[model samples]
Target: MATGIPRTKWQSAPHHIQPNGLNSGNTDVHLSYEGKKPELEILNTPPANLRQLWPSNAGHVTPNRLYYGDNLPILAALAQDGSVRGHVRVVYIDPPYATRSVFQSRNQTDAYMDLLEGAHYLEFLRERLILLRALLADDGSIYVHLDDNMVFLVKAVMDEVFGRANFRNWITRKKCNPKNYTRKTFGNVADYILFYTKTENYVWHRPVEPRTEARAAKEYQYVEPGTGRRYKKVPVHAPGVRNGETGKPWRGKNPPPGKHWQYPPRVLDEMDARGEIYWSPTGNPRRKIYFDQSQGVPVQDIWLEYRDAHNQNIEVSGYPTEKNPAMLQRIIEASSNPGDLVLDCFSGSGTTLNMASHTGRRWIGMDNSREAISATLRRFAKGLEPMGNFASKLESAEREEESEDTLSLFGPEETAKPSPAKTDRHHAITDFALIAQEPGADDLADAVGQWLEWKGESRIMQFREETVPYKTGKPQKLHRAKRRKQRR
Candidate 1:
């Protein structure tokens, strides 16, 4: 009999019942459920039949790809593709949260159905995650966005797949404004993102935000008498006793109990001589940190600024559940650098792909929903309208009165005027190939046709035949159609 603590139904199940041969020795705990497929079975999913609708521009090697298909087979195909497998540097997915509701675009078009629940949804996500893991490079990173509905359960599944040691951060984001709930529960305005790395060594560019004047004044209250520089004082001692020179006393003063000098005795003496150390009225020493020397405040896990479109002033793709572009920008900038491959299998509004492209990263986006594909295509072709407040703010800043005699900490400020604001509203998307998973699929063709009609174009580009190699089964032939050129 199991003692000490009672196990839940999932935890009490036999070790052999779980897929992937998960056991106590390998994984700490597993979420056992009926109809769970083995990892091998999931990874062996049939590769998608692929055909390119539009070829990339000349001299553009490794062009971006957009796929219209079920992401499971698409991911599997990518995992087997020589150029993509083990080459993806970043993956950001905002999958359906098993809300059991039908989502539609702002124009009343059906986007997708999130009907899966219980063990079925878990299995569905796990299958895709396995393939995503296979596509990740050794130093790659992934961020999974979800809400409270199924984030906890998925967290467990991710731990099993990505290994517990690779888990980085459980970031919380304020998704929307506060809601006045009629129910007993508190207002639901936040969601979560689970960040994980493929290995111990992963690419990371630390994200920082500009320090606001209010925050700077509050944090750096002290002003130097001679230099007029804003600064703050921090403790010169840190926790934990040491046996090195830092543990020894300097200037006849020892480190406090259970503490050690942050610097060596000689280093502290040099800093004191250079006036980098501050002496308190009571004679306590602290190191001075200047505000002008700081790059910025390091961003924290709880994000409150990058909220979703709430008011009419915010510009969006009209896709239901579209994420903030700024939020995606931060994630892409932090995880990957220029020319890195970024993958988003559940690319709803193509926000991740757009941000990746804007940041000079290669991107691949896949989605099965016709509405989603259409929205993404429209976003790429005709850029979203600039945010109402953003444009107005820029104009106002540019119109600010320029003064030549403005005083500064050092001396009078120079008479340099702010640069003119860029008013171009469209994003010039790099050339990318639009792929259809099945040859002559009516749904995909219809989506593309709708997009062309919306853009006032009559000609339809023909799809070029291509075969995606598979481990098992013969390659299927893709449908070929004649291209129709637009009338001049």
Candidate 2:
């Protein structure tokens, strides 16, 4: 069970029982029935005993932040904050996919535990999603990446949390090469990303891909003799009957009986005079579409180019389940603008953070594992020194050998104003602080207060108490209670 959340609210509906004769060994059956249902509940609940910290030497503060803890609490804390709430423009989370296996590193060191299965797994994700909804701006969007094991189930959960009407795309990404292991199923090579928006109106930067040589040659089959430029011919008349000017005659020829001119007759004449209309041997006039005028092909949902690192040399951080940076870059560029706030809660290797910074987007990354934090630190350290002209080289606090406790660094007073956007090739110093997780939010707050007393920057450090829990669960239909006859 997740802390600060009651089990009843997460599992309000009666558990559906699996039908007989189904193999109990198969986890797929768990999705069939006998589990908690999704529900939408009260949001705006605050996290208990939350603490905010900064580095004492930081000049200007950047909204980019990284938190070390279970994301539920971190997300709850952000949802309740006035400045951060409903301000995030884009969120991309690749959470544990309920694989029921403990992930380990190449040296056999434990990385993360994904043991929660069945209804427990569903409920756990549901609770956090509710908070995420409140945190998204009205025009913001979220992308949930999932492994094959849980994509279908999680899709249902997403539909319930974000209305089905707001659901965007079910993207299929080629995650790796074909697996050769002998198994009952086909070679697992692809995974899914469920995209959803807070509402019909959301931020969207149309993505374009360069047209391939073959496609370009095929589509632009015509070539202008004078300029030798590739072009295509399209019908100037469209499928519609109109009594307006578009239905009138052009060049002493009337539009086809069931069609209307795409442009006014005079406009068509002007295009013809400018050599923008192609006249076929039969005298049919078609509009000339040039290759140079196109905005490239719109990106599709089926992605095959970006995949996980194939070998150690190609690996960025060597963290387990690290995603491709190109993928993260695409998501950031397409869904968010420069200086927009981006979030990744299950920020395992910090791939999202790295891309977010490089792309000029402010970001917040949260992860609970020490190894994860260490990996993120290592990832940020590489090649950052060369970018010092635009970005300040990141500094990491040494981990104490004996205590092994979380450390909180107070940023400098210069960080109080919005940090300049790191748009140049050089890396500008992005305001960042690392916090150790305390037993309680109040404890963390007390630590912040104590540190502020010595540093004299209490105004910058803020904390919120987690008194009321933000309620969330997958949307599900509940059984109505039977009304009993009142005794006279």
Candidate 3:
């Protein structure tokens, strides 16, 4: 709990190297539990400080947004200003599950959460969730997609952040078909989506279908009394009586209990003549709701819509990390009506934004990987539809000083050429420890050898470098400073 530099660790140094934000230049650095294995990166920022992460221009109305940086810093930067403060309607993230599977691009393994069981994974979600909660609207929702490995931990964190009363539902998603994982415990066929709302009365729009077959079977199950088409029936009455109208009583034995006719005599007569009315068994008259007429069923917590991207020709772009659009479409439709903004900080493959497009919602997405960002840009560019209202909205909003893109991931410039070679150039590095994944004797020696020759020249022992080996849960790399001299 103690945040200050301890006297033991403080006194060891001449007192000049401590961070100016924490230890005053005069505070002796004494070695303590914190000092023995202190975290180097998490400095200066106070955990208690509530950061206000918001978009810069409030007037920009473009439905698309992509950020290329750490969500933490973005949140921290937002803390100083509340422009985007308290305005988001929904949020979704697919964080690293702490499985510790290092993602590789060119033989360099990126530090990712090891999905194997661990506590650090939970803390990571907890910290990010806390920041995310601050950015939510009063009546907003958050959906976190996680695996069995850390679902419980992530859920507990959300319960604490959003308050237990706001905890909505744990969504059971069919990720991999049971046929594939039949050998594992429980077949490992599904993943979990933890839903949390900011308040009880959050945005609750019922989902309307795109005239899909399943909905056709469900809502359009009944038949019209006259047209003989499958149709759902609705009572055509209100609870209260109206004024100045001849309330039409159809060839009916009075309206349903406590209800009055919805239309006046003339309108009821017209509908009756059109044969849109259905005489109920109770001798009450109702209206025929056409099958081709109704929207989709209200989306539920249990999702079965999206299938993971497997085929390259599936409009999925088959990027290394593409999310199913159906999954996000449901989330967007359920939480926001048309034109409302949705947020996806970990917007890998732009599923959230893509769904926003199909469903007519506005959205913003952000990610740190250049490859992922490029993929998203390419997806949009490939579509090549005229920007239309979405583009006009963006321009008008900017004129009005509204929703502006702060770190515009894409500027006026076109896409850059891909990195020519995907191979690990493995330039000679002096301190191989600086480039190692783990501190194994084998990889460490190999890594150092690469660093030394990292410059393409033969091994050089005294080149100045910037990186110190990170404390990667193993022996830290020890690269004492070397004197740099001019080499002809």
TM-score leader? 1
Per-residue accuracy of model 1 over 1-488 as CA lDDT, tens digit each: 32232233235557555565545354477889998899999989988865554431222244488888799988887776766788899999999999999998766688999999989999999999999999999999999999999999999999999998999999998776454333798767679999999999999999987777878999999999999999999999987677789888878888998678999988999999988999999888999999999889888898776667532226777788888777888889999989999999999978899888888899999999888888888888776643433334543454242212222222112111111112345665636767767744446666666555665665455422221211212342121222334222
What would the per-residue lDDT of candidate 2 be over residues 1-488, giving only the tens digit for each residue?
23343333354654664675334664422234454543434354445332233343323245677676678767776775665678889999999998888886443456798898877887788777888888899999999999878788888877778888898999998776443453798667688999999999998998887776778899999889989989999889886577899988888788887678999988988998989999889888999999988888888998766666431114445567877776888899998999998989899868798889888898888887766765665556441221112221231122122123322221231111111122224342334654434443343444345444544455444344211112112221111112232222
Query: For residues 1-488, could you state the per-residue lDDT of candidate 3 as single tens digits?
Result: 33443344344536455465555555422222211222223222332211111111223233344544555654433333343446678888887776657553211334233353455555555556766777678888999998888787667667666878898889887563334324535545578899899999999867643555665767677865456788777878766433445333556445554456888767988998988887778566778877765664555665554545431113443344455665676688788878676888777656676667666666667665544554455454343122221234554565344322222222222112111111223121111111111122122233333433433434443222322222111121212222233222
Alpha-carbon RMSD of each model: 10.8, 16.1, 21.2
Q: Comparing candidate 2 with candidate 3, which one achieves the higher TM-score?
A: 2
Clash counts per candidate, in order, are: 0, 33, 51
How high is each candidate's TM-score?
A: 0.81, 0.69, 0.52
Residue 32 error, candidate 3, Å: 24
- Model 2 / residue 426 / CA error / Å: 8.9
Q: Worst 10-residue stretch by lDDT in candidate 3? A: 429-438
Which candidate gets the maximum lDDT versus the true structure? 1
Q: List the residue pairs that clash in candidate 1.
A: none
Reference-based TM-score, model 3: 0.52
Query: Model 3, which residues run further than 4 Å from truth?
Result: 1-65, 104-117, 178-181, 210-293, 311-313, 337-339, 354-364, 377-488
